[model samples]
Target: MARLELKSVRKSFGSTAVIHGIDLVVEDGSFTVFVGPSGCGKSTLLRMIAGLEEVSSGEVHLDGIRCDHLLPSARGMAMVFQSYALYPHMNIHENLRFGLVCQKTPKAEIEPRIQRAAEILQISHLLDRKPSQLSGGQSQRVAIGRAIVKQPKAFLFDEPLSNLDAELRVKMRGEIVALHQRLKATMVYVTHDQVEAMTMADTIVVLRNGRIEQVGSPAELYARPVNQFVAGFLGSPQMNMLAGLGLQSSEDRFSVSADGGRLRLQLARRAEATTGDLRCTLGIRPEHLALSERGALRVTVTGREFLGSETIVSGTLQSGESIRASLRGAVEVALGESVAFEMDLDHLHVFDQDGAALDEVDNALPVDSRQDEVRQASPHHR
Candidate 1:
């Protein structure tokens, strides 16, 4: 395992700069993920690290050694791409050993390495099959096995699961997590999928337009996003942002009064500095809204979607803003029926006019109590 660092790394094609000055420190044996929307330059940065692309400026270091000038094979890293890139004519065993053979490793050493990787990936039985005869998942395992044979200092994956079906993607995700645990090697994974980043990464680096947005653990990014973009991108169903009037006070609480409706919210203490009748936005996750007999704002249900264990309820607030809430299970609330829902104030997220999060707040309830409520409310599961 080795530590990786990029200092003010940059890349540009002609006069058009894709990656701006970027500085990042990837700890030893850490599984770091670079995630963002398409055209965010995440893959460009990854390729720069792998020496597939030249750095416009700054340095790339591996294990404290400057390696920006080294060749891709000389950088002590193995990369698995989205395409699998398996040799169609070769059997799995030969494909896995091909890299080692090119490096002129001993015949005795190659077999042991191939066997061990096959055992780890549970593809020993598929050794005689060609890429043409294997399923997508099996082909992916062969590609990973090829990387394993190199025994490089770190592994790089570029959207390695994007080609698989949904079920296979989920299964392969678990396998990758388990593979990391077993190897404890430094791995850098790049993907546009927030779900993949959240599930697999020890630390997630969110990027936008060639610049790093935020880097944190999955839970940290989910619970305390730095900006509206990160907040909206990281969560399923996204976050609900309702435009409201801003109020400044030391009490750490604010209320939104719009269209003859008012909703009071407890904001983080850092928001106290913001003043004036500024146009602010209130951000709340779907899970934070709940049915309540006596609530502040009123909305009429517009749609309900049942998804087995959970239901997504869509409604329009009096101000004509659409809101979605993830209820535990199927709900009987009729469309166009007026319903009142309460917000968990402590769980509320506040953003400035620029969409930056104000501060972090601890608003999680005990897990056991939450599970109890879900069990009691969702009759289909029981």
Candidate 2:
């Protein structure tokens, strides 16, 4: 496996600049995922790494060797695309061997590589099957197998699971993670789905408007985002952002008036640089909110979605700001009912009008133990 680095990477179409100057490193044998919404340049950045797209201005390095000038075939990287991209007329075995054949590999050396790939992908039984005769998941396995046979220094995946059904997607995600572990090869994956990035990546790169917003492990980005956009973009149901007026700090406590002073929250003194009045935003995740009799915020129930094990309730604050809460079980709240909600104070986030995260509270909030469990279970975790 090889380490990949991008230094001041940039891209543009004429005068319209896309990827800004971006600097990042993909550690050897690590699974790095590039994630963002559409038009955010995630796909463009991945293509640049694979030599599928030219870099406007930057250096692409593999194991400390500059390779931006290399052709796609000379990069020693195997790419797996979203579309299966299998040759329709070729059987699975022939499809897996096509690349090696084109390279003029010794005939004796090629069959063993193809056989090993098919066996590892568990598609040995389907060696003779054509692309049209296989299921979507099977076809994807063959596509991945094709990459495996190449024995490249790294693998690049461009939303390889996006075309599968929900259940199949989940199944394929596990398979890919397992494949990464078994191979211990560096992989770069591109997807717009945060869930995919969260579950599969050792390191996640959050991009916006062609610039890198944040780069961290799933837990780091989730528990402590560097900005409002990073906070809102990584979570499901999204974080609730309420416009607030930061009040003066009193000793070790700080206060903020949100929802036009109808809601007030006291926080542990954090941002020592800002002691006086400031305009800011209060952020709390849905799962970190709960219904309570002595809650400081009042919300009027709007709707509820019961999803077997948990209930997602949407509401509006006194100032008409929308809010959502994820409760443990079925919640019995009627429409238009006013309810008081409490937040997990330690987990709250504060962002200035500029959207940058303020200095964290002294002593800091403890990382959630559940997050540790996830990392421990991930195959990519060192």
Query: Which candidate number maximizes lDDT?
Result: 2
* Deviation (Å) of 76 in candidate 2: 0.6
Error of 1 at 95 (Å): 0.8
Tens-place lDDT digits, model 2, residues 94-140: 89889999978899989999989988999999999899999999999
- Model 1: pairs clashing at backbone N, Cα or C within 3 Å: none
What candidate 2 gets wrong by more than 4 Å, as runs, is 250-253, 362-382
* TM-score list, all predictions: 0.91, 0.93
> What lDDT does the true structure give each of the candidates?
0.84, 0.87
With candidate 2 superimposed using the best TM-score fit, by how many Å does residue 131's alpha carbon deviate from the native? 0.4
- Tens digit per residue, CA lDDT, model 1, 1-382: 4999999999999999999999999999999999999999999999999999999999999988999999998899999999999998899998998899898889889999999999999999999998999999999999999999888899999999999999999999999999999999999999999999999999999999999999999999998899989999998888998886654444554434332334544344555435445566778898888876555446788998888878888989878898988888767777887776667767677677888877665442222322222212211222
lDDT comparing candidate 1 with the true structure: 0.84
Best by TM-score: 2
